[model samples]
Target chain A: MLFEQVNNKVVRAHVTAQSPVLARRGAMLGYSGAVAFRPVRGQGGGVGGFVGAAMSGESNPMMASEGDGAVLYGYKGLYVTVIDLDGSYPLTCEADRLLAHDANLQTSVQFVGSGGVRAAVRGAMTGQGLFTTLVHGRGPVALLSHGGAFPLQVTGQWPVGVDPQAYVGHTGNLSLDLKAKVGFRDLTGRGSGEAFTLQVTGQGTVYVQASEQKF
Target chain B: MAGPSVFTAQSLPDGDNVNPYVYSIGLAGEWFISKGAMLAYYGNIRFEAVSRYASVRDFVAAQFASPVYVQDWVVAEGQGKLVIGDRGFDLNAYDLDDGNLTIKASNLLAFDTRLALKQSIVPGFVVLIGTGRFIASSNGPVIFVEPPFRADPEALLGWADCPSPAVHHDAAWMAASFAGALQGALGRTSGEEKQYDFTGTGTVLMQSSEIARADPAVLRLIEDQTRLLTDAQAGSLGQQLMARVQQR
Candidate 1:
């Protein structure tokens, strides 16, 4: 699966699945030559394991099952430019430096840049919205999403909580902190549903979904 | 503190080019076991003057007769013409003075003036002996001697915190052996740069330059001191007596 921004406001995502499968805006999945239904694991399980799996032919339950490739949704239809198989691709970008991945695909990406342009793009991807077309010439932006690609955008001040592992990308200037549940009496998994949360604060938009709860 | 310093002796390894493994004794100051002597002490040592006698030969001879705390004594003559033992000082022909009666060494342990002219009828012979408490120096070899003779062991040993020469010798030997073992364990060939990687809990990393930079003199001092202390305890003063003979 691949995603790109065109025309400055629209997000265009291209996914190739082995068969027609149901995918939601916040759905969590995996991709390797093809996209399929799979559960994302943490650092010990996700992309790291995929790299190891692809090289050794070892089975990785976190990666989307075999046969799922090339799936499309909405109205954007973009042709594939490069299919990297040798594993020599340099996935370098400004934001990649601050991003960390886990075996279960649970990780955190910090956005840092001079302006809001980068943040806007990351906000669009994490926000729950449909990307009709690609945005052009916004700025260099870094985004991290979990499982499969989804189109989204933030409209206002509503900040979103994202699963650290499922985060594909984000804008370049959001301050981040780890959020833990409050109050000791509620420590039994009752008051605080999640043990840890990634708190992002900024005026810019953030996109996240209920489906990314696993990360 | 006011008297002539007492002297204890230790042996050293004979260096290369010398046969019979000649022994060298270290006295005081830069007086080292000859570089030719093997099994040398590699640490510092200090000698104390327990008693000063005007007639050193007589004092030594008297000590030999009774031996005080001396452990062993033997008298021999002929080709060797030497009396060597912990409790006795046997003299050779050259060791006698012009009078052929008095024993004269540059450094003498004298007790009285008239004692020098006195001679024993033992023929071309000499014998000296005594014992004192073994005291430890703050940073040098430990000496064994008759205890009641000295007031303070530290003052007698001449240092406040010096380790005994025996300790220094052991440390040196252990260090040398350790370095050798490390070199071997690393598969280092002779003349090659050696590096040791101690990677576990207490790790140590060393290079050839470091080993080369160590002082050979210091190593020798420790080894010599250790050997002296051990030999003294064992009552084998071979190296100790040889050292005195060479000094004379």
Candidate 2:
């Protein structure tokens, strides 16, 4: 496939007449050859298309490209990360983190909110929505972060705690629960902003980037 | 992409940057970290309040020497790998060997206990004395410049082995722009008119950009310092502060 990572922070997609690519809206920097950038009508019109947007509030604001030409996609200078998939495990990602994915992959909104538990709002404090997008049957999925993300392996014996803002995504069967350590200082408005945390457990790899997305 | 480097507790580097924005600490005992900077961790690490932790009371007394930072800091103790991030800024680790460095408090992320921290004479800055390792974040990659250079206050990361700085206002520009008015309500001046003039032999660290760190604790720091004022002055200052708050 000619559509590959040009560098650690940019992606170069080579589009052919038969092979089209989907990208985030306004992510095109520059392109050459005969290319057409059009809105993917109703997000390709399928079960995981419009339904995913309405359910998860995941707005692709997406655009599709066709024709025999190469296109470049980049975010707002964020470090671009390309993750190659083999259809072995499904990858879950934040809706805004999606850059470009293969045409074969299916995107859907997956509910991860707490079932009436107030604390388990699933990244509510960090400005992440309750429903995150899931990508499967993929070829390559590109992610974005302020810098690149660091992947940490989680085991059943030990659990991992992550700051809500820095969390990017994860793969495999993982459960996240909120752990707030409210100190006496919170009453005086001097509380450590670190009080809210996401405790992750299960068998999977959790991804975290360096910069917290401030709402 | 075949894969990026996968890090585990054992594989994460000790006291190093995992990426431009993330720092990894191979912690065994304890480290002083600014609240909320921690991103994630592996192993049995517990973060305890600096003001409320009874077990750390003596350690706090013996090690922590700055009261201004008490409310914003915590002691993380345990065996494991800890990762910390600061709002997407570039993270840099500096090793102080029997030397001292002063940094903007908001940029400080974590420091080893071996270093004694003291409030700097300059407001919003802290001085670290002794030998230890510390992490600081900047809006961009830090640029090292020698003395005889004036820097924008917002771009300055810190300075090592340098004496206190003096404010350098461009009198020429002030005269040109504001008719030489130093304290005029109507004087309109560019933010660049003021700079920190540095001299002597030392290294000055600056970020590439002028983006400032969020300083929520500055209010508290100013509140603490206002205690040194007389009652009459305090009352007048209180009214001014109230007016300023309302204006905001």
Candidate 3:
């Protein structure tokens, strides 16, 4: 793995000439050795990723860092988690959640509502926009979240329900559907604060943070 | 390197903390959860607003006695592992075995249905009584201190098994400077001059940081208490409040 967790809230990525690092702009806490950071526009998914970011309102301005040293990365005091990708399952996440990742990984835009209009509505309710960033052929992807984030294993038999505000990312084959638990009583009274929940079906892992605070 | 723990539907702990900022409540029957506190849940569970649930469930009205907090709490029922968190604050669950704990309303996250919640006489606080578990959040790690001490109002998280703290003023500081005296006379002292004085035997819970969230119920509680004041006094109080706002 190129990214090693220095602490719960920080990650140290060993940067090399061959394996450069794409990191969030202004997230470099510090670095050692000779590392050069250049602001790169639309660095994640190329042309398609740029257009998707504009359309999806999920813009993540990244910087390219390359040198022969270790670079420390952190953002907004958020906790960091590194997911190792074996080129099997693509990691789906919001662009802003991406802290740092191997520049060798392939990036593309994926529709949050891969199932059409109904899924689009779910995506809107999640406040994550219509398109999400998909990292393919990743060596290691670093993500940030409030408090910290943990993965919940999802199986074919048991589905997991998550609050959209707490969702960080997911890996493997999974279908996300929005379930509204609202009823007549909810319409009448103050209503349940948690009226909508994101249901993850199929098989994979869902990453969620301890907080429901919208970023 | 090892990352955060991975939890499954069956592996989530029962009424235990997943981390310092997250708590997992294994639910079979019911729990009184603060509104917007839940992060996620596994299995079958339903969250009903206390206002709506009070009409259907007889016990809701009996357990939740603070009307001001009705809008901020919900009842989660059924079988599931409910996860809750508060704005990245340090969270801890305390067990109250037939005891009472008065806590800052905004800091008290969730409580058991077996415990009864009552509005504390202290404006912005609530008391939980009976044998059950409840979760609370603090800006930092909670520090346990004893009685015969004075605490800054913002730093005081809560006091358990003790009479409500009395307002304490630093008389020496008040008399130290003319400007300070003037501010105190105008009821606009630097906020460091006033404190909560605790006496008797009890544990006082304090957060390492003084930052705290404003309780939404405080306005209503203060509004409700206004009925005791005469109209002239109320008018003067309004003027004072407006002056304070203007100064800010």
Among residues 3 or more apart in sequence or in different chains, the pairs in candidate 3 whose N, CA or C atoms overlap within 3 Å are none
Off by over 4 Å in 2: A1-215, B54-57, B180-187, B209-211, B228-232
lDDT of 2 by residue, A1-215 (tens): 74677655557788887668777755654454656655442242575666667666765666566677766666655667777777877888777788877666777776666455553365576456676777887587788887678888889997799998888888878877778788889877998878888888999888888888631
Candidate 1 chain A — worst ten consecutive residues by lDDT sum? A74-83
Q: Scoring only chain A, what TM-score does candidate 1 earn? A: 0.30
How many clashes show up per model? 111, 1, 0
In the range A11-114, model 1's lDDT, one tens digit per residue, is 22343332222222221211223323332221224666445433432222221222333321211111111111122212211221111111111222222322
Return the lDDT, model 1, position A134.
16
Please give the CA lDDT of all the candidate structures.
Answer: 0.26, 0.75, 0.81
Cα error, residue B217 of model 3, in Å, equals: 0.4
* Tens-digit lDDT track of model 1 for B66-94: 22212121211111111111111111111
- Local accuracy of candidate 2 as per-residue lDDT tens digits, B157-190: 6888987878876555445445424333232433
lDDT of 3 by residue, B1-248 (tens): 59987889888888898888999999999899998899999989999999898899898899999899999999999998999999978899999999999998998888989999999888888999999999999765666667765665665679999889888765544454345345442332344446677888998876533344677888888898899999999999999999999998
Alpha-carbon lDDT of model 1: 0.26
Residue B126 shift from truth in candidate 1, angstroms: 99
Off by over 4 Å in 1: A1-157, A163-166, A203-210, A213-215, B1-248
Better structure of 1 and 3 per lDDT: 3
